[model samples]
Target: MNSLADPRVADLLARLHDEADAQRRLIRDRVASLADEAPGPEAWPHHMKDFYLPVSREQGRFLYQTVRATGARQVVEFGSSFGVSTIYLAAGLRDNGHGVVTGSEVVGEKAETARTNLAAAGLDGHVEIRTGDARTTLADPGGLVDLLLLDGGPGLYLDILQLLMPRLRVGAVVIADNITDSGAEPHPYARWVRDPDNGFVSNSITLKGGTEYSVWIGLP
Candidate 1:
């Protein structure tokens, strides 16, 4: 049986992805519109505070599998965002029977909500939600990270990665979302990871938005 299909995981996802409701899609669109207006991540205030730009169901499942596949005992996520993505990562850790996920979110209320969501899923014990800018919160997360997920502001992806570089295990996997778009401003993160000399083998994966799957293959 697929690990995500577990009753605990299935029950939580159902609450987030209500396909029958059209309003959610509209809200998401409006949030995306606002996001497009931001000059850069630092100027991008907490416009998405009241809403959740969550990972699509497939991407959530992909996160679960990715963690499980890597046998990661420690995971770090930038942008917990109400914990929809956090739950996926923690679920994988739960199935592994050990491990912890440290999630950093810029908004305090969202971090609280994510904590509530994680508790409701019965995986709260395996996760930690740090409320503040990821750049500061993830500066020292207590241990080496086996997998890193960058789902925050696209502009901050590279910065977050750089901040966590020292703690990432050699084979760590870094997944970045929203890096692929046909716009005047492209995320510079793509170039850094795709370059073989930079110690990563990376490529874009087409999902609801777009996800960059990269593996850290450099020396410690």
Candidate 2:
């Protein structure tokens, strides 16, 4: 189940990354056009329809390694845009011998596309694509979650995390994407997780975009 080496997984990931790369210019233009607008999630749907928002190739590999290293049996992903990141997470779980990655996507079309991509990579068995706002779709993950990934709307990151906070296993890792350059959306989430009183040890990792990497120390 070492999917990293599996030709199908490799092929699918490569193609998806290329698709993202091709949209880089469009994304840049869109950002420039909205330079005067306060950055937030309200405009996310428009962007999603215009282009693909995905983790960079390196970041994707990092996600796979992160999940595998943690020995996570259950993973909760706050976003599954086209399933690019989902593939990486599911691959990690498959390599772990047994695990599941449950992903939440608010966009119905993106959720459908994501499922198709995961199936194409032969990793569908390890992923569940729940279509709806993560806060509601992930109300309960069945049991303790060993890892959480937040790559959806920044404005909702804190809310999503709060919804899943009680379900986190001690030492569980939370990885949030697009944390920087999105104005103040991530500030609340960063503050909450970075505060020792909140029971999380958190720091930012600089990827293509910033990612807040936090570890849950659990309730004292």
Candidate 3:
């Protein structure tokens, strides 16, 4: 009963991966210029509105599998972009027979589009896309989160994680994307998660963009 293998979910994911691949070149060029011009996340949603800087297909599958394996009922996603990852998370929840994916995206347009895509995949009922700063929109997830995905701005990873710390149940899993390139020094988020004092035990996983897979062990 793999929901990802369902025609609706699989077809949508295929289309999304293709779309992301097509935007690689444009995203590379736009990001280079945006880095010099705007230089921060404030302008990203607007400038990169047309781009899909989304998670890789492999990452999406990992997220889905994590939800299923953990029997997660509440999932939080920081930076859903156009909802590519949201669909994966939602599908997992749907197949779990219950659960929901709370997604935050600063761009209203992208959020709307993401909702549309989820609807197309028949997973909208399992997802709620909030359009605003994740720091605020996800302030209260209403219940303990079983899994968290940090796929938004690299700079805000730690901040968002800390903010949601109180609501993450023990043994909760947190996955942060784009932490570092292969062989590069760990990103700040990685450093923080890998510190035992912070209540997590984490290590990097080789994904398209470096991924930090961590588990909550409670404060030392």
Candidate 4:
């Protein structure tokens, strides 16, 4: 017995798979390089809750490209899990002459690890590591955010969204990671961003689970 599907569908699936694999390979290479330069095990104590799920190097490159393309000079991130994403954001900011990527990590150890990692990546100067709950840290961010990455607590996403909206620039970009889990959409963030009144044009792409990209449309 043979179970063959439509030729076109199969072809499309193959193409997508191939693309995904290529992206994975790229991300792997980047992560490996980062690992080589990362601080020793002594820095582990400062990390936040072991939520150090690093983004693929390809994803990091994609993020950097997005930030550079936007010409954003100020960036803010809600979670600095070992500074993996922070390095990527800082790389982009570095290329744009002068910019800062401020990140908050609730755990002191994790924040310290992030600091060490960013420093090893030669990005410490371009990135600021804040050790505390993101809610409190964001409450008084001293800069305008042209780009925001939400990788902190998904439960606090709505609250973070509300808090950061006012500080975002007119054409700011917000990227949220981990939107779905095992085929179940677990976070309300995507829904909130999709709401019409939110003034955010958002969509989810199936990359490393699922990532939501939302473009803020300024205040109403």
Candidate 5:
């Protein structure tokens, strides 16, 4: 029942993860160069266009399991760079027998590349990659979202969450990446979701890039 174990998916994941590892130095250098001007999040897509910035194999597996466990029919992913994570999400849907992972990527080239990669994994049928700003591309998911993955620009995490909240089914899962505890303060997204007043019960878990797992409880 694990579509991720399929040879096509397993092989592609290995290659993508290896590629991401090789780009570590370039990513670090790019971030360091931005230390001076402190460019806004909008500048990140351009700077990171060429990088894989993929989720770790563990994180991808977690995503797959979450989808299967939840029986999620509608999943949305923000920041599907090159679709490494998208492949995992889509694989989950395929194994579940029905569902779709709607992904957004601002970089047009990355979106196309992601589509190709998904096809290579034999998962293109379970995903839709929308190439444009998530705010616009993800405006209407066409149905209630059963799960949402926030792996895009940190600054836009809250914005995108708010935008999609209305369409998120009660008890829906929300997984945010890069929510590390390296900072003295809790990340804004984590803070918002952890507050019961915000209608979510959330907790941060030790996983690749630090994962914030939350469930929508609806307003009290």
Candidate 6:
């Protein structure tokens, strides 16, 4: 909500700010200490999508860590921006010995850049970058997705849900980022999934902007 001035919102923001700052320092230190050939040039590239609001590398790492903690083997992402998150996810997958990430990007350029970045990160083989509307691409994804990330257009959030609902495997974790409306109630996706019929246990966390985390409960 735009009522970021509210004490609750302010407190949440402060916590996020502190956490983000700590994460940035950690990422910097990790990157700095890495051997020149450790990550390698093929580990992650520089070209990002135009709309890519790069997440704090730490946030990316955290997401990856969460996925790894869940022991997720297959992941799907609604938006692939510059492959920053892709790199993080791929790193976790690599560490897990066997995993894969499939990301969708509507913009061709963004998809291309994502591919390059994944290749740079030595993750191209572990990640698949799809160029098209995510809703459609996910409609018939070949495998059960264990984890999902939503960072595409806000208005399309519900559409993505409808498309992915039937495909989501039980126990899957869905993370939706950027769910704010400045004084408005929760976003449409949050509202819709809150309905009992949707079969999702949902909660909002005020992370960077706002993040809605949901898990499927009912059988598809």
List TM-score per model, in order.
Answer: 0.88, 0.90, 0.96, 0.74, 0.96, 0.73
**TM-score of model 5 (CA atoms):** 0.96
| Model 1, span 1-220: residue lDDT tens | 3546777768877886663234587776866897678545554547557667788888888999998899889999999888888999999998888899999988888899899989988889899999888899999988889999999878788889989888889889999988784675435788778878878888889977779999998842
Q: In each prediction, how many residue pairs overlap at the backbone (N, C-alpha, C within less than 3 A)?
A: 0, 0, 0, 8, 0, 10
What order do you get sorting by lDDT, best first? 5, 3, 2, 1, 4, 6
**Candidate 3 segments exceeding 4 Å error:** 181-184
lDDT string for model 5 (35-136, tens) is: 876877777788778999888889999999999999999999999999999999999999889999999999999999999999999999999999999999
- The sequence of per-residue lDDT tens digits that candidate 3 reaches over residues 1-220 is 7889999999989998898899888888997888779755687678988888889999999999999999999999999888999998998898899999999999898899999999999999999999999999999988999999998888899889999999999999999999883355667778889989999999989887589999998999
What tens digits encode model 2's per-residue C-alpha lDDT throughout 95-186? 99889999988888889999999999999999999988788899988899999999886778888888888899999999998877357554
Q: Over all chains combined, what TM-score does candidate 1 have? A: 0.88
Residue 24, model 6: Cα distance from true site in angstroms: 17
**lDDT-best of 2 and 4:** 2
For model 1, the superposed segments whose C-alpha errors exceed 4 Å read: 1-3, 19-40, 43-45, 181-187
- For candidate 4, write residues 40-158 as lDDT tens digits: 43343243244455665556666788878997788898887777778778877777667889898878877897887677566677888888878888786777789988887576777
In terms of TM-score, how similar is model 6 to the real structure?
Answer: 0.73
Residue 47 of model 2 has an lDDT of 53
Candidate 6 C-alpha lDDT tens digits along 1-220: 1222345433533444455455665566555655544653323222222335555544665677767788888888877866767777776776677788888887788789788767755667789888877877777766787888887756677888778777788878888878764676767778877666788888887676777888888743
- Candidate 6 — which pairs collide? 1-183, 2-182, 2-183, 42-120, 42-121, 42-122, 43-120, 43-121, 44-120, 44-121
Q: After TM-score superposition, what is the CA distance of residue 91 in candidate 2 from its true location, in Å?
A: 0.2
RMSD of each: 3.0, 2.8, 1.4, 12.6, 1.3, 13.3
